[model samples]
Target: MSAETPGPRRSNYSSMPVAYAAIGASSAPDLLRFPPAESTPYEETLQLGSGTERFLTAANLLMTWGAQRVAGVEVVDIDPGEPSEYPGVHFTETGTPELGAAREELFTPEGEAYLLAGTTASFVVGSKDPRRILVVTTVNESNRLGFAWGDRDEVAGYGEQQLTVEIREDSTVWAVARGFTFQSSTGITAGLKQRAHVKEAVAQAQAFLQALAPGAALRNGVAKPADEPDENDQSADDQPSA
Candidate 1:
């Protein structure tokens, strides 16, 4: 193992200036929401591709709770066992015309072949110090998919989030996450807050396409930074919006 590692804590800044790290490095623009406060709503969007079944199919992988076990994250509880486990890990079909009215192709209700509108699951983010659980509130494929338990469990605040990926009439495929979380988590430390959970979602969005179609270059969505630099349209930092 190397003597140095990447994590939330470090002493490198002890001998240096600027509060444990370079201001530019630690103060990267958070494309989530700014003026971070309690009960705030955050959204991050990404342009994936043209509207088509192919893109929706890629998104379906996320709704099916399959991506939770991907490269950087892993499912912690995503299986149906007993009723005592009221919040049993399971996927239920949210019948959309895309899957047929009866959703037969989705498999028997008790079958493990698919996920519907109400499907939900849980997962952890980091390998060394998995901090919080990402919870799902809804998983309606191709129509309306969302989450209702992340910001609450994470930010000492509470809110739900939904990711909508759809092709517009112009054939542009867009994926966006809309959610609410408390402005400040009571117990979480400073470095952790700076991680920007919204950014993680954005990365996950990109990963969806990467997994479905490797080498695909998903475009980043632009957000208006909370603060613009004096006399300059850009923020105090030169970083572009993610």
Candidate 2:
């Protein structure tokens, strides 16, 4: 269920250095192949335990912004209303419609709110400020699920982050996060900002991996048997009377 190829130079993405340049390059062998000129790239991949369930769980967390949430960053979804005019292809459906619909129904409410191209979200990282970005590309193939985004001029640098989860032929599920960025500041300030950015990126990537590791699915939406009590669940005795 691939989306339409994005149109060139859409007005909504003028703020990015080269909008959509890194669209589908997130999982590429080489990150440099499609990044904006001169931007530095980074990537991290975690091997999730093998299974179809693991892949779906990881993908669900990703679509719901699990990485940012687990890393202690706040996510704010920016609504664009119906017939969204934001940049990039807007479809989130992947693989065949049946499979895509199944995943969507499982992860999102009403099967209509999964992340898609043109969707926008802001990551509020501490008191500094929120970084808003627009999705530029998405992959919803049978074995792979991922999405990439471009900076929306809300941050100090222009860049993007791509997140994906895939199941190999052997049924091994892997989670990956990769992106490119260049500080907009100059001289000494730029150096400091770049280092900080790299640190934050790596931290968030690790959080993403941790969110999908073994035993993570329970908290992430995988159902636990009704007879078993979740450690995090509050017992009736612990609740105050309303």
Candidate 3:
């Protein structure tokens, strides 16, 4: 998505009826074109004073699109930005009509299928780190999905993972958690699936960042310098004993 495309402007649900269709036409095609590939992982360093909110927002947009299209799920945008009664948990409602049924459908088997599909899409969109730092699971009843981001201490330093569980009235659920340490210093070099999504997500994030801060670089994982000084710079006097 181009920065000129606009940022989270009033949700695209109205203009676009089928969310999946829009994603397939816009972002999916690009992702399919440049699939992720594994190579020597290296981090992309951002200039000091860079803001990461743009990247996070981009990621959220992609996740929203994928979730809507793949699982037929809609993320709830709770105003006031306050924590819900569930504490750390947010709520969204979904329903469908039964052919001749009126007042719109709130829960149904079809809705459940849509939720499952959307969850898969959301997972694919959010899953970037090749280390398998994130895992997505499904819950049939209660229409909820669970995501488990594994403990970070296992891979990185003292860090904690994030877990997100989503449920729709139709009994569709999506859950995700931070599983592994993601090093931005090493660009995603895992495999096609990993690289493609990450690259696209990163690119989209970059676009958003550029808009937010023209020259600032948004760092997602770890930051590392690209170029190292030549060994010749080390004087003989400074050389260590062989």
Best by lDDT: 2
Supply candidate 3's per-residue lDDT for 103.
15
In candidate 1, position 222 carries an lDDT of 22
Deviating ranges (above 4 Å) for candidate 3: 1-45, 48-190, 214-242
> How does model 3 fare in lDDT?
0.23
**Which ten contiguous residues of candidate 3 have the minimum total lDDT?**
96-105
Q: What is the C-alpha lDDT of each candidate?
A: 0.36, 0.59, 0.23
Q: For residues 81-102, could you state the per-residue lDDT of candidate 2 as single tens digits?
A: 2333533433322321111121
Residue pairs with colliding backbones in model 2 are 95-140
* The best candidate in terms of TM-score: 2
Following a full C-alpha superposition, what root-mean-square deviation does model 2 have from the true structure?
Answer: 8.8
**Residues 1-242, model 3: lDDT tens digits:** 22122211123455321211111111111222321121111112122121232222212222223222222223232121112211121112221111111111122211211121112111223434322221112122222222222211223211112223333344333233221122223345534444454454444333322322212212322121111122234322211111
Error of 2 at 56 (Å): 1.2
* Backbone collision tally, model 1: 7
Alpha-carbon error at 66 in model 2, in Å?
2.4
